[model samples]
Target: MHLPIELDRDRAEPLQNQLYEQLRGLIIARRLKSNSRLVATRFLAEKLGISRTTVLLAYERLISEGYLETRPAVGTFVCAVLPDLVPAPQINDNRVDDLPQTELRPPLFQSRMPVGEPVEPALIDFWGGPDFRIFPLKIWQRITQHVLECYGKGISRPPPSAGIDPLRGAIADWLAAQRGIIVDRDQIIIVAGAQQAYNIAARLFLQRGDRVVIETPGHAGASFLFESLGATQHPVPVDEHGLLVDALPDGSTSLAYVTPSHQNPIGGTLPLERREALIEWARGAGAYLIEDDCDGDFRYRGMGPPSLKSLDPYGLVLYTGTFSKTLGAGLRLGYMVVPQELVASTVAVKTLLDNGSPWLEQMVLAEFIASGEYDRHLRRVRKTYLERRDCLIAALRLHFGDVQLAGVDTGTHLTWLLPASLPSAPAVQEAARQRGIGVYTVSESEIGGRPATLYTENALLLGYSSLEERQIRDGIAGLAAALRDHRRAATG
Candidate 1:
């Protein structure tokens, strides 16, 4: 049988490394069962349209990594004993040791949730979004009050479609310093939020019957938006490292929407290798890539990878970012950095779509960034979220041994693969719900297209940004108890 493997000749990553990663992912995910026979290198190479030497090198790497074993004169097969699924947490080369997972008192800003109170939810829901409790209410209020005192007149008049000059310039400066992107303010179009930013992008690049590439189990909102625009979507599967660039459609693709920096639902950060490959593919195919960096600012892994837009020299990337992940989603503020050619078109589209975002908020945000309070706020929240994430992971390990997780060491949320002893992800979700706790299956969350079976069948998405350490720990314990009750009921 032909293995489900594809290679991209245009990618900068070596074919051998590409093949090895795919095979390794499959093996780790258990798609290739223990002792499952692999086809001969010659046959596999021929099937994949690559040289036999490439296949041999990939196989050798897998063997050395303990994923496969070759029986002399017989055939190679998946190893009966695979490598440890729960390897030690990765420490970036720049860091000496992992951050302590201990829970510290939250910053003073996080002392109050929305409505100016610390009321806890009855269900203990871990709904994904910004933690409103951590919002810099005092600073934001001071800025808002100041902006109103100064620019209150502009609020009554219609704001510029592309955004106010101060905010745009401030955003440009912020991107240059934080994300290594040096685009002019004129190329930046502020919108209601990521939703509107995506809508603007979909309108510009997509037409009826146009082909759009989307990550499977990606942000459902993006898929729905493209579909509503009458663009036919092509689903590309994502592994732990984010979108499988090799699996991207070859040609006739008008646009490809990606969440390279902390993908929604799955939580994997796209590595530099695949980021380069994606850029190459977009350039060669003459298509546009939308890089959604919504959660890019909340990386726990020592100043994570650079934005994909930073690596794109071809003007093919449309970088979208939002404050919803940091500030409250209720604020509804987001921006998109477009190529020079599309700036006018995007501005026109923004003009037509609500004529721009709120003026007062934009003014306040501009001052917030210019004064460097935004950076300080991010540092505070990042530390808090990191502590919560670690607490959640530790809770899972405490309740369920050897917890297999994805998209860890970064992002506000992570994906957990339920052990075989537990029920399906949906079933687990139901059990958790019955116990007045919130957990989500891949499908129940904002998944874009159909996810791989490994994710859909067993993985549950958990968001830790909104939860405190105590809440995270309690939620996991409650979930574990719910699963136990569910299993007992099923057996009976």
Candidate 2:
């Protein structure tokens, strides 16, 4: 009789091993009764379309393992009893209620970010990601080739948990010149991305029942991270000028995460006056601040205010930024400039978290920054993004009468408030999506619980960094048509 066995040629596992495991599992499950006669090797091989020798090897392993016995004159047969080491599997009735009732503890919170299969991209996706066309691939390729030649052995070895010297130094120098922040190279720790940096910071600073102040309608990623750590989150509202410093509650808070340079979703930059006030608040409360300058590298307007970290005097701000926005997110490269006091703990935590970021990426990025190629590239990309931004603004005006936009002066994304004539932001997003255009509602982007205010209700976010001028215009036109169709359908 042909055994109920299946084999795959494409899997990395050897065919003989797969066959052996299946046969052993079947025998242990008692699917093949004790002392059942087995098929001839030649017949089994012909039926399975594998070599006769492959079947023989599987049979030999089974026999050696006490799952099978071979009669000298006859074909192989199942053993009457399994070895002491290979106990027979206890067969169950396949009834759900009969299964043991064990304690099933679910996670405290569900992740807001999308998981599993990635959401399908729109025909003209406005989701914020780097424009691959503008990426300096040739320069990177040359640097990568050079690194491979020079540091072939380095690839085999693990890098320091804190990071390599060259990359840390390069980042320190760049921050000094660009953001006006003076930090030591030793204080910088390379991390997988901004998310990982946030994780490291949370681990270092937060504990159960600790209080965290998060910007409402802010970054979902940060909100989720803080909450997952069992920290009690106190959400502060944001306005046209970013987080409301005057509205900050008077109390003790362990940590606060802010995107000051270009406030996410709403697109407001924290002004210098408020920045000073925020620093003072942190000092009074003795809370640490995490500055996530995720897209600070690309600024259209000339020189926004100095970073919150640059203005910080108490060394309470842990400044974090990522090359994902400028380079590519797939690289998963980011850095955190730690304070003098926290450097040791940061390094320890980083070492505990997967040893360290990869070596080759850090090396290539160091070369790119030190060689001044990174600066040159940013200048070119900034100019291109400005043109795209302008193109999107014009298209919006042309399609819909003069629209109100925010956070347009900086960052890759901008926010739009739906007009009185148009449907709600979520409705608009759905209409645009149906027409193969991607747009996001503000609530969709924010994490911590929504406050009573309707800041997120009528607002939509549009990311134009990845789209070209033509695509932006086309996308807006399509969006307009979709909205019109939605209105028509509602009226009918």
Top lDDT: which candidate number?
A: 2
- Could you tell me the lDDT of residue 156 within candidate 1? 91
**Backbone clash count for every predicted candidate, in the order shown:** 1, 0
Model 2 ranges with Cα > 4 A deviation: 1-90, 94-118
Estimated TM-score for each candidate: 0.74, 0.82
Tens digits of per-residue lDDT, candidate 2, 1-492, equal 657898999999999999999998888778888889999889889999999999999999999989999998987999988887776576578866665554244545655562311279899988867899999999999999988898768888899999999999999999999999899999999999999999998998899899998887788888888877788888888886699998787889899999999887688889999999999999999899999995788778779988989899899999999988898889999999989999999999999988998999999999899999999999998999989999989999999878999888888988887778889888898899899998877655545555425566678888899998999999999999999899899999
> How does model 1 fare in lDDT?
0.84
Q: Per-residue error at 153 for model 2, in Å?
A: 2.0
Q: After superposition on all CA atoms, what RMSD does each candidate show versus the true structure?
A: 27.3, 8.6
Tens digits of per-residue lDDT, candidate 1, 64-128, equal: 88989999999999999888862433448776344454334343322111121224443777765
Which residue ranges in model 1 land beyond 4 Å of their true spot? 1-122, 445-452
Error of 1 at 379 (Å): 0.9
